[model samples]
Structures are given as structure tokens and as C-alpha cells.
Target: MKNSKFAWLLSLLLVVALFLAACGGKEEGTKTTTETDKETTPEEEEAAVVDEEQVLNLIMTAEIPTMDSALATDAVGFDLLNNVNEGLYRLNQENVAVPAIAEGEPKVSEDGLVYTFTLRDANWSDGSPVTANDFEFAWKRAMNPDTGSEYGPYMMSGVIKNATEISEGKVEYTELGVKAIDEKTLEVTLEKPIPYFLSLMSFGTFLPQKEEFVTSQGENYAKNSEAVLYNGPFSLTAWDGTGLSWKLVKNDQYWDKDTVKLTEINYDVVKETATRVNLYTNGEKDRTSLDGEYAMQYAADPELLKELETSVFYFKYNQERTGEKTPLANVNIREAISKAFNKQDLVDVVLANGSVPANYLVPKEFSFDENASDFRDVNGDMATFNVEEAQAAWEKGKAELGVTELSIEILGGDTDLSKKMDEYFKSQLETNLPGLTVTLKEVPFNVRLDLDTNQDYEIQVAGWGPDFQDPYTFMNLWLTGGGNNQMSYSNPEYDKLVNSANNELALDPAARWQAMADAEKMLIDQDFGIGPIYQRGLMFLQKPYVKGIVAHPFGGDYSYKWTYIEGKN
Candidate 1:
């Protein structure tokens, strides 16, 4: 089964290769041969000499909530930050970590707890040189309790020395283990030897910020394109705090500016599928995503591109609301709802976008062991769909709570496809479990994120894409009092298993892997902390002239550094 799954993935990669190739040479050759048989007009000859426009117009499903690296918690913000900011390292086309701002490799201590890096000469968009102090200031700012950054503590705690203490206000942020030895040198001390530290450096949370620029803005920092500084391949422009449109122009001040191909990239938030498809079909946009029936309709289209992603969607059961335990706090109730929905049908019929039903938190083809074995295959599936079992559990839960009927509201996105999926879930739950009422509350993407952060909903359809390539990224979210644990689910044993995997078992590769696997099973099979839905798959359309857009299974979805325009007139 694993071999076949990998074969499927390889075929998808081949399709991606063809999509990026854009079928350029052969079509141009044939066109030239046909034109040779006839006399070409002077205007036609002149048109042939003109260069194609080096611009890319694209569509986004959601609006970017914030540009602040310390506060971003969604994909849109991360993707935007990824293009406009520079970090110590960046993931290459092959998803391997490579130095970006750092000169080369860091000199590591023999004990593997300290690293000293020599910074390369790079400049921000304003012509000031990027310095080691920028990194130190940014890291300390994020770790400061006053910043209220969820990712800061969640990502750096247990890894960086004194980070946990600084976030908890037990120590000052100045003592957070990062120091600027010189303008071009930075020294960092870690609590332990982290296996994925390089990959983590490429994430948005670790991106640098200029202290003067950020402080000058005061409350306005990163509120708009003009307020933020850029040091990456592109610089954001024409963006207001809450606008639906923005543009990214090539950053001339970037260290490797010569390698950038696209001069401008424009984006507009489009929520409806019909509008997105119309924009693509009318040649107003270079790319658009397909959903539901559109995905099936374009399955054989030459412009269609499909990729199975590493992200997974699930039902987050909020165990507590307003300091009171909710019905979802009961293990039986959570388990009943988890097993009530038909995930296979949800993917095949409702989604129809190459997605697969997911029974576990960690996705397949994502994380691997030291021996190159896929983690999903080793752990297998857990808590799959069973209507009869769901019914039995629901009765028991109702009896325990002394209730004949129960009502709960689920919060989800207001996108056209999202509404359809929400309606289907409501129908399935209400139909399978008698005397149960499911209410749907659909809001815009940004609004939904706010609600999730406030824990204002009873149940929410949430999704997570890995910030880095590791099983721990998915497993760590449910830790006791974790920043991302908005659902209020906690288990001491689960915490012990996850902490040990990253601490005492850090040197033991096999044992660490086992501990993480055990934690995932415990979260799903035993506690029913969250219900797994489906592994995401993307099907989209791209113009033949567009090329070199690199898609990653983790972190920011696509990188446009090497993307370019070609054959189109």
C-alpha cells in the first residue's frame, strides 16, 4: 500500500512538471512552421519581437488578516510574509533548508547546544544593511509577554534557552539566549539539539525585523505595505490594512535581486468559485483553484494541475467555553461526533478535489523516520467512520448528561465550497444521531480565525499545514496550555509523551519517533481530542505562459522567487 501511495505521488509530481514546462518549445515550433508557409505581415513580425509582460495576476480565497510576523496564524499571512521577508535560511525547490541571510554554515559547539553564524551582506528595502541586531531584536520582541504572540512561545519554547521563561514573564526577554556579537555575526544558544532547527528558521515566526522601522510605526507597524520593511525577493505595495487587493513588486534592494524574474505579482481576494473560474477563463488571472464540480469538470483539462498536500482538516471540539465545561468535554460525546460523519463520502462527493479521508492527525507522505519509513504506514488508521458505533456512543453520552436532545453550533468559512461542506456535515450528524441539533455558522476567513482565537465557537472546522517538516509540528498543538490549543483539551500523559519525544528521547531517534506516534494515537483513539476529517488536495488552473512557481508540502504554499512569464504575447 505504501509503495502504491508513493507511486501516486510520483505521478502527481510528473503532472506538476508538465504544468510548469508550459508545453513551450513544441507549440512555438509548430506555430513558426505554419507561419513560414505564408507571408507574415509587417505588424505581425513587429509583434513577434515584443517581449512578454513580466507580471502575474492571481486569486486568493481569503484576505490577509495581519502582516505582523509575531501575530500571523494563518496561511495567507505566512505566504505573504514569506515573499516579503528574509530569514536566516530558506527552503529550496527540493524543500531542503539552505542559507539565505547567513553566509554559509553555522559553527556548532561540540555539545550541539550553541551555534555561531556569520551573516551575509544583505539590505532591507530602505537601503539600510541587514544586521545581527535585527534578528536579536525580533526574537526578543516576539518572546516578550507584552507582544501576545501565539507562535512565538509555541515555536521557541523548549528549544531556545530561557524562551519559555521569557514568554511566561518569569524572566526578561533580554535573557532569551540570542546575542549580536557584531553587525554581521549572531550567536544562539539552544536548550537542546533540535533536529529540525534549520527548517524552523525558514518559518515566518523567525523572520527578522528592523528595530527602528518597527518602533517608528508604533501601533501602525505592518498594518499596510508602506509600514513594513522588505528584504526578500519581493516588496509588498498598494495594500491597506483590510483591503481585498495587493501587489508585490520585485525588490531591487534584495541581496539576490538579479535572480528574480517576475516584476510584479497582483492578488485579489475572490471567495466565489464562479467568479474565480470566470477570472481564469477570461484571461484576467494567471491561476485559480478549482473546487467541487469544477474539479471534476477540469480533471482532463490540459491546464489543470493537481497536488496532494500535507495539510489536514479536522473538527476541533471545544471542551470548555467561558470557563465552563461544554458537552464536548465528555469523551463519549466527542467520540460519537467523530465517528458519525462519513469522511470517505465527504472527500469523494463533497470535495471531489483529489482529497483523501484522514483518520489520523499526522498526514501520510509528510513525516519520515530515520530509516525513511513513512509515519502513517507504521501507525495505521485510527477512529474511522462507523454509524452504528456512533449511535451507541451518542445514547450513552445523552444518558450520562441526562439530556434527550442537544444542540451545538459549528463555525466554518463562508466560501461557497465551505458552505456546501458545512451543510453536508450538519445533515450527516443530525441524520445519524437522532435528537441532535447541528447549527451552522459560516463567516469570512478572517472572522472565523478571530472566533477560533477567542474560543467563541463550540465546534469548528479547522485545518493546519505544517510550519516545518516534522511530525512534532502537528502533535505539539494539543499540548497542555499550548498557545495553539484553543480547544482546551489536555491530558498529562499525552503531554509527557510529546515532551519526552523532544527532550529525554531527543538523542534516541527510534524512541522519539515512537513517543510521538503514541501521542497521536492517544489524542485520537483514547481521548478524541479532535476528529480527523480529510487530507487536503489542490486542483488548479494555470496559464501556459506561467512557469517556475514552486509548490511546497509545508510552510508557505508556493514560492514565486524563480517564477516567470514566457510564450504569451
Candidate 2:
């Protein structure tokens, strides 16, 4: 009996040992699985730690309105479109087209009218495949009269065959030049060979559109973040359609996204120059705008001074809005207004950002003439500052219209600085022209735009800088029936001059430049569609740690893409 009991105890011990061995094996397998799940290499661990404590905060001088690239026309629009979506080509700081979506520089057909681009299998922020049809759909829809797109004619006129005619009801939108050779290739044909054609592509009109989203959103298209898809370095979020404030977050699906280091970009819409300056001065912002009284104050600050050399500022008038502009309608009156407003005075006194006054459409330092100052004929006819001469011309304008009252309506920006300038202009106009009373109205940015485009107000004050390096960008607005030609000003001769310049003179750089300069003279020295105030200088106050920001004379068109905030703890 004792021997049997001892054998039973030994069997129990063996069984216990087997159970312990099974449990030990299970723990070992579990630990291996955990390690595999947590297996991040040192490089990846460092990347994950980026912005671990907080997001990088980037502040802009304006608010973002929409993420949809197809319809944006303002600076905010340009920023979002440039960052969140890319076209077949993109512009460098020099406004030169570089490959962004295409395999490389596009191949031009024998006719110079057709453009064939090979795609690089880009994906949307959502990881959806980007196809050639996207470009086709965007180009076609832009030309469709039903789309009511103002930029369509501005961008597609010469590039997309029949694009202008179709938008104007002469041809069907389907007849537009863009086509998809396949899912990976896009082809576009032009009405005429444009020398600045590639530059035009850098604008927002050439960016791709999702057909499904366009059809689904309709008027509300591009009105919100959720309604859009982006393939650029970032996806826009926290942005309203109104452009009051916004953010651009990294797009994980971008083909060349590995180089993008920004975690979040913050933009705030600030129209008041003083307010913008305060945001930067108070340490509340890493980067902010400078305008008006603060412009010169920051000019001496080396950090801000570097950016001020490259911006353009001008005054755009809504001619249709001015009812009794009969007197102001005279080309003499337009010229007089140009002469009466002492641009230098505004810059020296009103603008502290050290903005220089301008008398011409393009800046003296722009990319047109790199070897020399862009201000050729610095002794040109338009450079004279003759308030007394302007007074004499105003008298002639009054006599030509036979207006006894010589009344006019003027629209100005709603900001505090604009109000002050508007007041000064009012006093100056009354002081300069006898019997002329210029009624002043102040409106917000969007409403001001409506009044300008719809001709709701007369003599509205506005400004424009080029979207790219070409003068055609600014001059095209005055083309007959142009969406931007809020002034009912048109001349066949002027249109012919500009069109011919684009076609015949495009390849001849010197000749083309001369032609464009002549066209600018025709508008300013002739039709008087707009008043040149001051070519704006780019102004920003950023802490020294901010790096990789380059300013172009064209505008802030791509500064967002190339800029990086360094030491962003």
C-alpha cells in the first residue's frame, strides 16, 4: 500500500510540472506579440515625438474661407490651394513652373497648343487614386457657363480651346480643350500659344476638381472642409468659408510628403493693420502682417524688413457702381485722380510698414527685368507728381461732362486705416476739384467684393497684386467683359494689344515685355480702369527662429509651401 501511495505522489508531481511548462510557453508567446506591436525603430520613434507636447502654431494676417481650390480667388484661397492641392505644375519663388503632379516638365505638342502631362500616381488625402479624369472634370466644369466661375475665363481663355467662347455661350463646355488620355495622363489644347501659359497653370484655375464632389455640393461646393479632398502637403481644417481663421494639417497621402515638417498652420483674418502689428508685437503670434502706421516701424526691424521688398499694392475702382461718374468717367479724370493722390504722402505718413508709393501697375523690383530695375523710363510720362495739373485736368473732365455738381461715390475698405485714407481722399478730392462731393461708404471684405463685382457701389476702392510674375495677370482684368472688369471699361484696341502680346510676342521676351508695358500704359495712361496707389511691400514680423520663408514680388502666392517654422517648441 505504501509503495502504491508514493507512486501516485510522483505522478501528481509530473502532472504539475507539465501544467507549469504550458503556462510558461503561453507567456513567452504573448510577450513576443506585444513586442511586435510596439516595434518602432529609433527613427520612427523620433518622428512620432515631433510636436509631442503641442502642435506648431503658424499665424497668418488673414482668415481662410475654403479648402476647395477650384473657386478661391483671394490670398486665403491662394494659400489653401497652394498648400492643400497641387496641379500638374507649381511655381517656385521665382514664379517658375516646377513639376508637382506631373512626372516632369510637360511635353509640348508640335502646334504648341496641346499640352501633354504624365501623372505620378498621386493620391488624395483620403488615399483615393488621383486620375486624369479629375483634371478633365475640373477644366470642363470651370468653362461651363452654368458654373458661374469668374476665374475660368481668366485662366482658361488661351490655354483651353474654346474655353472662353464656351463660357460665354458661343460653344458647349464639353468642347473645352482638356482631355484624359487615360487614368494617368492629361492633355490640354489652347486657342493660341501662350508664352506665359505655364505661369497661368500655377494659378488656381488649373487645379483638379473631383467630379463627384462638384456635382454633389453645387453652390455649397468648396464652402467647407468636409466637402473637399486634397492631395498637396496639407489638408485644410478649422477653416470656414468666410476666411476668418483656419488651419492646414499635414496630408499623409502626398507623394513627396516626407519632406513636409509642419504639423499645423494657424491663420487669422485681420484687416486692420494696427491689429495685425499688435498680434506680432505682443508675442501672441510667431508671424503677422504689417500695414499702415506700423509698416515703417517694423521696416527697421531686420526680421520684418526682409519680406517688405516684394509686395504690390494698388487701388481698384468699381466703375459701374459710380452713377454720375460721367465726370470721373473721362480719361482725364482718371489721370487726374492718379495725379491728385500723392502716393508718397500715404506711404510716408499713413503707412508705417515702409511701403513705397507706386505710380505704375507692376513693381520696380519684380521678376520681369532681373538684371536691371523693373522701372524702365523712370522718367516715364506717368511718374510726374502734379496736383495742380490734376486740378486742371479735373476741370477739363467737368467741362467735358458739363456736370454742374460733379458728384461721385467712393467705396473704401472697412478697416480703420482704410477709413482714414478714404477720409483723406475725400478731403483731397473736394479740395482738388471744385464742386465735387465724393460720398464715402465703408464695407467689409466680402461685401466689398460683392459691391465691386456686381457694381453695387460707385468708385469702390480695392487693391490687387499679381498671382504670378506676369503682367498679363493684372492687365487681363480690364479685358472687355472680363469677370474682374467691374468697371464697364472696354476698348477693342486695348484688348487687341493684350491678346497680340500674349500670342505673337510671347516667345520674344523683350518684345513681349515691351508689349505688356504698352498695354499697361493703355489702361492707366488711357482707359483709367484703376488707380495705382502703392506697390505693396511684403511685411512680416517673425521671431528669428522662423526659417525657410521666401517672398516674391508677385505676392504671397507660395510662401506657405516653401516656408518652415524652425525651433518650434
- Please report, in order, the local distance difference test score of every candidate based on alpha carbons: 0.79, 0.61
- Which candidate number maximizes TM-score? 1
Query: lDDT tens string, model 1, 1-569?
Result: 01001011111011101100000000000111222235546465335434867899999888888888888777787777778888998867665668999999899999978889899999999999999999999988888778877777776777788887886779898898899999999999987665456556776777899999999999999999999999999999999989999999999999998778789999999999989999999999999988888988988777777777777789999998888989999898999999999999999888998889999998887767667889898679999999999999999999999998999899999999999999999999999999999999999988987888888889999877765445666777788886557889999999999877666776677788888899999999999999999887777888767766776555566678877776677
Superposed by TM-score, candidate 1 places the C-alpha of residue 16 at a distance from the truth, in angstroms, of 34
lDDT of 1: 0.79
Off by over 4 Å in 2: 1-67, 93-95, 308-312, 317-319, 322-326, 367-375, 378-383, 507-512, 552-556
By summed lDDT, the worst window of 10 consecutive residues in model 2 runs over 19-28
Alpha carbon lDDT at 334, candidate 2: 75
**What's model 2's TM-score?**
0.83
Off by over 4 Å in 1: 1-50
Instruction: Evaluate residue 61 in candidate 1 and report its C-alpha lDDT on the 0 to 100 scale.
Output: 88
Residue 526 deviation, candidate 1, in Å? Answer: 1.3
